[model samples]
Target chain A: AQRVTQPEKLLSVFKGAPVELKCNYSYSGSPELFWYVQYSRQRLQLLLRHISRESIKGFTADLNKGETSFHLKKPFAQEEDSAMYYCAPTPPTNAGKSTFGDGTTLTVKP
Target chain B: SAVISQKPSRDICQRGTSLTIQCQVDSQVTMMFWYRQQPGQSLTLIATANQGSEATYESGFVIDKFPISRPNLTFSTLTVSNMSPEDSSIYLCSGQTGFETQYFGPGTRLLVL
Candidate 1:
């Protein structure tokens, strides 16, 4: 069974502080992981993917296969960065069927 | 990325009633999926609407309770039957483009009374 675990259900940080949203997976095969963000009153949107290796909105995630983790990180958190984040792991064979992790609600305080 | 839209942005319905949610993608997408998000929970995939064929439902989701239709490549619909207070949640429709990135629609919020 492939499982994505986001241990932190809620995280709070002050503006300009570094933030990292933890995500761990229990998949045996190589997994393609992605981060999705949902701002207040906005639709859920893709933030970044491990395959892309490109940062979006100053957030980046690196796939750590040894540890089976893909943690999203940002150098400086902003008030606008307060949102819900989900970690999704998609198997190569199952491209559209991704197992999403329990989301983390990050609150960046001003 | 495709722009997805959902109908009946929010609704309040009584128990035992059914509500149909429509989804439309501005551009053609390779795959369409329906998901449910309970309050303060993660998104759980309901089914995959296959064009010109019966939908493939996920575990714990049945066709009779949540019938889905995808008559074309850019449109789909999901009907929640026999509603209850437990069914109150946000239902989202997503389109997976050729690039494999998913674009989600503004979900339809259903509140069962």
Candidate 2:
């Protein structure tokens, strides 16, 4: 049973502050990692994926296979970034079913 | 990215009743999945609905409790049978495209009293 853990249940930061949402997984194999965000009253949308090696909405996550972690980071947080963020890891073979971590609710203060 | 939509965005049902949530994708997708998000909790995978085949459910989920139907690549339905108060959760439908990016539907909020 592979488990995904996001240690922080709530994170608060001032605007323009650097933010990092930690994510750790128990899977040993190469699993794909994704960051999903849910704004108020909006559907869960993909923020970024580790396989792509790209950044979206000023957020980037690097997959560290040795540590079994993929931590999302942003240099400067914006008010719009306040949302519930989830880290999901799926087996490379089955991309559809992903194991989601308990979400971290980020609040950007003015 | 594929656009996903779900029917009956929010519903309040009574105990012992069943509610079917419909998921529709704008384009054909390779895989469709059903998930349940309990309040203030992480989303749990319910099943993977395969077109023209029986759904593959997760460990805690069963075919009898959450029957799923995927007639084609663009559509699927999940029926929560004999609902109880514990079944109250947000049901989400997700479609995995060829690019392996998953697009999710606005979840259907279920409240069983």
Candidate 3:
């Protein structure tokens, strides 16, 4: 069974401060991880993926296989970055099915 | 990525009635999945809609309660039968275009009273 755990339900940070949203997963096989963001009154959209090895909106996540964690990080927080972030792990067998963790609401205070 | 659209962006339904949500994709996709997101909760996979065949539901979901149909590669529908207050949630459809990343629809918000 694939499971994703996001320990924090809410996180608040000051503008220009670094932000980190922790995510851990339990899967037997090589896992594919993703970070999804949903803004207020907006649809959920993909923020980044482990396979891409790229950063978007100054946010990046590195898959730590040893730790079984893929935490999303940003160098500096901005008010516009406030949103709900979800960590998901794709099942190795099912291409479409993904196990998602309870999202963390990020509030960037100006 | 596929451009997916869902009809009835939102609705307020009475208990004991049923609501069918429709999902349409711009291009052909191999896999289409339905998910439910309760208020302030994580997304839950409800079923996998396969073209020309019956949908494969998850452990906690059943075909009778949440009927799904995928007549073609670009379209699918999910029907919530015998709705109750507990059934109120945001229903989303996602499709994978032979890729590891899945694209999602806007989602249908159902409020059962």
Candidate 4:
């Protein structure tokens, strides 16, 4: 079974500090990884995808196959970055079905 | 990417009644999915609404309790039947084109009393 794990339910960091939201997945085949964000009162939106290899809103995630992790990281945390972050994994065969981890609520305190 | 819209942005419903959430995509999409986000939890996929076929539900979800309809490529609906307090959650519809990232709707917030 493919599963996504986000160990931290909540993470707090001071503004301007580095932030890392841990995510790990277990799957046999290659997986497509994604980071989705939902700000207060806003729709859930795709932040970034491993295939695109691009960063959005100053956040980036690298797929580490050896570690089975795709941790979201940012060099500096801003108050505006406070939101819920979810790590999702989609099997190569199942394009529409995805497994999402229990999201981590990131709070960037000012 | 596809643009998705969901109807009944927010609704407060009686316990024994039902609510139907509509999802529309701007363009024809290959895949449409329904997800539920319980309070303080991550999104869980409810079902895959395929065009011209019955929906495939995920574990912990059933067809009778959460009936889904996909009459076309760009439209789908999820009906929450016999709602309860546990059914109150944010229901989101997403459309995907060619296995890329999925575009999500604003979501329908249902509060069952």
- lDDT per residue as tens, model 2, B22-105: 999999988999999876677888999999999998899999999999999999999999999999999999999866678999
The model with the greater TM-score, 2 or 3, is 3
Q: In model 2 chain B, which range of ten residues has the least summed lDDT? A: B36-45
- Model 1 chain A: weakest 10-residue lDDT segment is A90-99
User: What's each prediction's clash count?
Assistant: 0, 0, 0, 0
TM-score-better candidate, 2 vs 4? 4
TM-score of each candidate structure, all chains considered together: 0.96, 0.95, 0.96, 0.96
Q: Clashing residue pairs, candidate 1?
A: none
Off by over 4 Å in 1: A93-95
Question: What TM-score does structure 2 among the candidates reach?
Answer: 0.95
Error of 4 at B90 (Å): 1.3
TM-score of chain A of each: 0.96, 0.95, 0.95, 0.95
Candidate 2 segments exceeding 4 Å error? A94-96
Instruction: Assess the local accuracy of residue B102 in candidate 4 as a C-alpha lDDT between 0 and 100.
Output: 78
Q: Candidate 4's residue-wise lDDT over B1-113, tens digit each? A: 78899998999999999999999999988789999987667988999997888999998999999999999999999999999999999999999777657789999999999
lDDT of 2 at B97: 80
Q: What's the lDDT of the predicted structure labeled candidate 3?
A: 0.91
